[model samples]
Target: MSSSMASSLPPLPRRVGWVGTGVMGLSMATHLLSAGHSLTVFNRTASKAAPLLDKGAKLADSPRAVAEQSEVVFVIVGYPSDVRRVALDPDHGVLPGLRPGSILVDMSTSDPSLAEEIAIAAASVSCQAVDAPVSGGDRGAREGKLSIFAGGDRSTVELLSPLFEKLGVLNYMGGPGSGQRAKLGNQIAIASTMVGLVEGMVFAHRSGLDVTRWIKAIASGAAGSKSLELYGERILRRDMAAGFFVHHFVKDLGICLRECQAMGLALPGLALAQQLYLSLIAHGEGNLGTQALILAIERLNNTRLGDGGESSG
Candidate 1:
């Protein structure tokens, strides 16, 4: 959207509840609080929720408390099992405490089947559910420019557009689990691109070419991608900080691979990328950013990317 158009976005829903305030979630929830929403937030680790509390967001005791206190509860937790525990657990989960007509929007990159299950559970409570997984990583989350892939009832998704607009581009995919499917497709593309970027950079390093210049030379060509643009400089500097964690990317790719297998499909590129990322995890570098894939490449080729100084990646 144009700058002028974005500046004119409607106000977000006033009563907002956010569960999971780690990394991207913290920034996402902060955007809603900044937009003057009466925000209530919950995180398993109390310290992670501290930043939001300092920003005037009320702290909720549990998922149920969060759901009970707000009309729209947004969840961006870790795994599919975590999503289930937070959204579907009978006693303390969000669904059990959600009021009729309330909306449950899970932004976690979880199982498509799990999303469908959550949708069905929400319906029983007269609540609406949307699987709205997002991309753009930490930078995008902090800048409120995440690309959200949503799947649910059309009217329900439309109703939450204003809130989504505050976060980033919102694309309505289809029904129930479609959002997770879209996110899986996104991960597949990302994994492939990451491999390409790392291999290209490794080749540059071996050729004794200036890695930074090499990236700039082809960044706008057919070789360019969001991953390359966002991570190229970091690779050159050997900065492997977790903008998007390696382990999380592994989780996403694992989900995509399982889905592909279940569909009787084979994507060799995605499988290769998954194997490479798993190698990184095996090396005990899973806590590093996805950009740290370069380290794995460097190890395989016996070549490093950055200047021979303080080694990080």
Candidate 2:
């Protein structure tokens, strides 16, 4: 999609409902709301959904309430379990309230198998479902520049194009759960790159080079990457605020590793990254952003990012 304003999106759906109002979901739902779509939103925690309410979105009491009121419902919660609870739980979940021809879009980075399960459950109710996990993190969501990988029927995907375009570029992978597979593939690459990024920065600091200057020097060259360009400066500044939370990335990597095992593949790099992130989680830093993986590296080497202070808890 181009840089057109989301408010200019035409052929908007009759009513849009959003579930999950956490970090990423809040911005994504705001895009639809700003586009003048009639939006109803629900989150497990009411306070977190308050911002959307202030922006003129109506508050729904539950996922079922949102589903009942909207033609198309979008969910971007925390984990596969959270997705299942909001989307598939028998009594109060979205599925119980969704009309037969309505659409359900799951934007969370979650398990491929669960995506398939949701497809089946929605199918049983004659509802359409799409597993459309996203990338570009919080910055992308807030800027409406997310890259959405969609997996569902072609017709359903095309029908949702105008709305998806409002959020970001949309690529249709294949049948149910394929979006999740693609997302896991992305996580694997990011996992390896993060390790390389942190290790390179550690080496630079150990060698007495300016870490920030080193990043700028190599960022435009062969060593440059999306991760390096996006998160390198944040790492240098020790800004651990979550563009994407370490816990969430760890969940994504755990999914990737499980998928690898199912396919009889051994990706040692991904395994190592997972281990390192788990260490961060162990230190009660799971709420910190993925950039905080550098902290784990610092612990291993008994060093710091730039100023050589003790690693903060």
Candidate 3:
């Protein structure tokens, strides 16, 4: 349908077990708590989780503890390995304790296969499962404006709709593994677009054009994006912060490359983007934001930032 006619809403869980208190998870969970859902949270680092507890979210001793106490568990950890450890660690796995009729939503950017395995494991416990990765980053999460891509059974998707609404705009993409496929699709698109942005900033600088004017002028037109309009200046100036970590993007791009290889598709731009990202890592820029790829691009063009990279958090 038309853009304005499309609803923009996020679902709130009835009771949520929010695992992985990282940058995005904290804010998303906060939205649910604020929506009046009872929430129990667990983070490996207790210090990072104390704030939620103080805000009236119940604190759990572990992932399993959180799962046992809540009807729905939402996880958004770092990697596939971490997702495996926290969600299915044999001794105290969330899988063993999650109540029947409960659901487990993995919001981590993980291997698609891992999502399937979690689904099977959840089934064994008579619980439902889905992989529902999010986008729109930390700011969106805090503002309750993320876009959630979910994959699972139709019934489960319907049941979870309200929860997704409270957290972000929701799209029930397809059956199992579809959420991850959509996420991979997004990464592929992002890798290409970000590399192009890097190249454009580098070009503007080497040409001695008023980069602010050049970038803004183009951005005001069809070439604009949330990434460019928001992060363009920071990337152009090489002012890297920790909003969306370069290391995290590195991991995501790597996954996209693997998916490409398995499909026997040639993704030269993504390959190039991966190379550029790796170059940034090799030069110790991993902790910087993914937009820091602009720095590497500038170095390749043998130039410096126009105004030395002014920053915003």
By the lDDT metric, which is better: model 2 or model 3? 2
Candidate 3 structure lDDT: 0.80
Residue-wise C-alpha lDDT for candidate 1, range 1-313, written one tens digit per residue: 1223222323345799999999999999999999889999899998999988999999988999999998889999988889999999888899998877788999999999999999989888777899999999899999999999999887778878989999999999999999999999999999999999999888877776777777889898999999987888887777889988889999999999899989999999999999999999999999999998988888887767666322324
CA shift at 240, candidate 2, in angstroms? 0.4
lDDT values for all models: 0.88, 0.88, 0.80
Q: Candidate 2 — what's its lDDT? A: 0.88
Name the regions of candidate 2 deviating beyond 4 angstroms.
Answer: 1-11, 307-313
Deviation in Å, model 2, residue 97 alpha carbon:
0.3
Candidate 3 weakest lDDT stretch, 10 residues? 1-10
Could you tell which candidate, 1 or 3, scores higher by TM-score? 1
231 in model 3: Cα distance from truth in Å? 0.7
Which portions of model 1 miss their true places by more than 4 Å? 1-12, 308-313
